[model samples]
Target: MTLAPRLDRQPRSALLTVVMSIGLIYALLPLVWLIISSTKTQESLIGSFGLWFSGPFALFDNIAQVLSYDDGIYARWFLNTFIYVVAGAGGATFLATLAGYGAAKYAFPGKRLVFAIVLGAIAVPGTALAVPTFLMFSELGLTNTMWAIIVPSLISPFGFYLIWVYAAESVPTELLEAARVDGSGELRTFFTISLRLLAPGVVTVALFAIVATWNNYFLPLIMLNDPDLFPLTIGLQQWNLQAVGVGSQPIFNLVITGSLLAIIPIVIAFLLLQRYWQSGLSAGSVKQ
Candidate 1:
């Protein structure tokens, strides 16, 4: 007979709780500041304490300005960002899911080489590759185009690695063999069987990819010169930059309010996908 170990629940640590509370405050401080600052007028922003509301609440007024200012370029930027996230992040997740599952399941030539290359790529920051990528795209006459952003975003080594590990552990080889014995084609089996098991991993990778692509600044800044093609990150920076050089017109309040509005979608995405993300993270906690 096998004996199970006794499980004892310990009291929660006060020190740990305090540390977490401090970390929570640290993380939320900037967002709180952004929210509060967004409600202030231009002069109130410069005049008042950062954490408190000052003067009249101009959040609605500022939002109106953000949506209407400069012929509503912010709206266009938001649309561009949405397109990039859908194409770039969505493609990255799909390709990563396919590649990772293949790598985890199949034995192919140069598999180790591919793994090594992915690990090396993950170690290298995107900024390091930005210049080389720009030069390559420029040679292909693809610079200043949306493809410049979307194409690079598609190659997510980290996402691929994540799915590879997840698929190997979470997906059962016996189940795959059973499907094959039942005469299911590889494509059909993967789509019908493997994909459902990979759902949590897929959602986690998608969220990461979406956030990365949505918040991408350096890539778009170098790849696109056209203001109309700018995502929210670059567009917001442009608005902030208006304070510099000759004929300076600082719309600091609009910048603050725009920033507040910009983060809403990402927060919404997290809230919507939180369940899947949590499951993905906790999936490996217990041995099956």
Candidate 2:
């Protein structure tokens, strides 16, 4: 009887292990292919096997060419990405945290209405707002400017919701009351006590904002006509356009290399900040 039960459980465990392994491969396969493909020359990229090494690695050369191409415009795109991610993500995180903390902790008139509006905003797709955003930026004479991108990225409804839920549950009401009793004003208490407690949630929202803004293409594409002001996403699209002709332009190499470079910042940011994400989730679950 003991042997029979053990055998049945073993099959279930074995099946689960296989399923998890398959899922892992499915998730990582494309990334592996990209890494391999980025290391190959144009001839090797076409002639080589899809998943295996078939030529001398040109990783360094490809990177050099990508960085040096078109008077080092790729570097400019990189700088633009840094500006967008830092300003967009950092600003959005701060605003969202304040809004969320206010909604959750304070008892004020029209609070419910404000919360409803935020939820409605979250339900609305970003793409739906792009046209209006373009028109507004155009009217303000901000088209083709960095502000056009940064301004829109600063308002993230989902980010607000994340921090609101986090602040409500992670921050203890008694702590705020005790701080007030100690002669700390609301602003001081928020800056000193609540903000530190909410750091993990803030970091989580910032990461989401960074990724969203970094990958934003349609808005930048529509808002900015200047190729010099393009982010990596739009720049890559331009390379793809150049690659379409059957002549000796040979922009396929640049397109592939640019695509690979575009992914680096997001990957690095995630790897560095993922610990905060873990800490945030755990903090949210802890008993207040």
Candidate 3:
């Protein structure tokens, strides 16, 4: 008989492994339930056991209904989410990269104050700024518009900070001096040289910003009043509200299925981008 690895020599390591395995199961249990629940019909979902398959398989049916419901509003929400993530996260990443690289490399006045302010912003809760932002945007007539979502998401203190710390160490001054000596402009040097080296940090920041924008609820809830402009977070919430109302057509199945589908893109994005992130990190680790 094959023997298990000896744990007597490292009890703490074995204990930690056991604890982490339990934690992993705990984290994954809800997702497993969601998958099983989503495959069941609305009636079965209500009557059947939550952790196991209870009703007739309605996964495809549920997906079809989710796609077709209310003139396909889910499609619109998906598009809106795509736009918000792309524009908001992309803009934030670009700006963060520029600011971070500049801060790390350049000598300037008030740089410390700028860094301090960014650090302070990181400490402040996002919700604390929501009401004031709403008031300001309301005055500017930007509320209930895509700009409301996109504009605020453009600022990522953590992204900037991450890149700043990373660039200060990962990027070398010698390379930049060489570029300058070769008569390359700042923009050219950044695009051709610095950006490639900063890929991992940039991708990390972009992913963070993308997730924040994708899963954003509170800001969208307060800023937007129109259903047409709602992202998946708000749109799904509206469906949940309708489902819970007295004598309402229970769309619980559709909601669950839609939610499962909604997460696919994000999962795919992470999977697709992870190799690049890893390669960048690996490259960054090498000595110049």
The lDDT per prediction is: 0.95, 0.86, 0.90
Query: How good is model 2 by TM-score?
Result: 0.91
What is the Cα root-mean-square deviation between model 2 and the actual structure?
3.3
Q: Give the total clashing residue pairs for model 2.
A: 0
Model 2: residue 165 alpha-carbon error in angstroms: 0.8
- Give one digit per residue, the lDDT tens place, for model 3 in 97-144: 999999999999999999999999999989999999999999999999
TM-scores of the models, in the given order? 0.95, 0.91, 0.92
User: Who is ahead in lDDT, 1 or 2?
Assistant: 1
What is the alpha-carbon lDDT for the whole of candidate 3? 0.90
RMSD of each: 3.0, 3.3, 4.2
Sorting all predicted structures by lDDT, with the top scorer first, yields 1, 3, 2
Worst 10 residues of 1 by lDDT: 241-250
- Least well predicted 10-residue stretch by lDDT in candidate 3: 279-288
Q: Report the lDDT tens digits of candidate 1 across residue range 48-154.
A: 99999889989999999999999999999999999999999999999999999999999999999999999998999999999999999999999999999999999
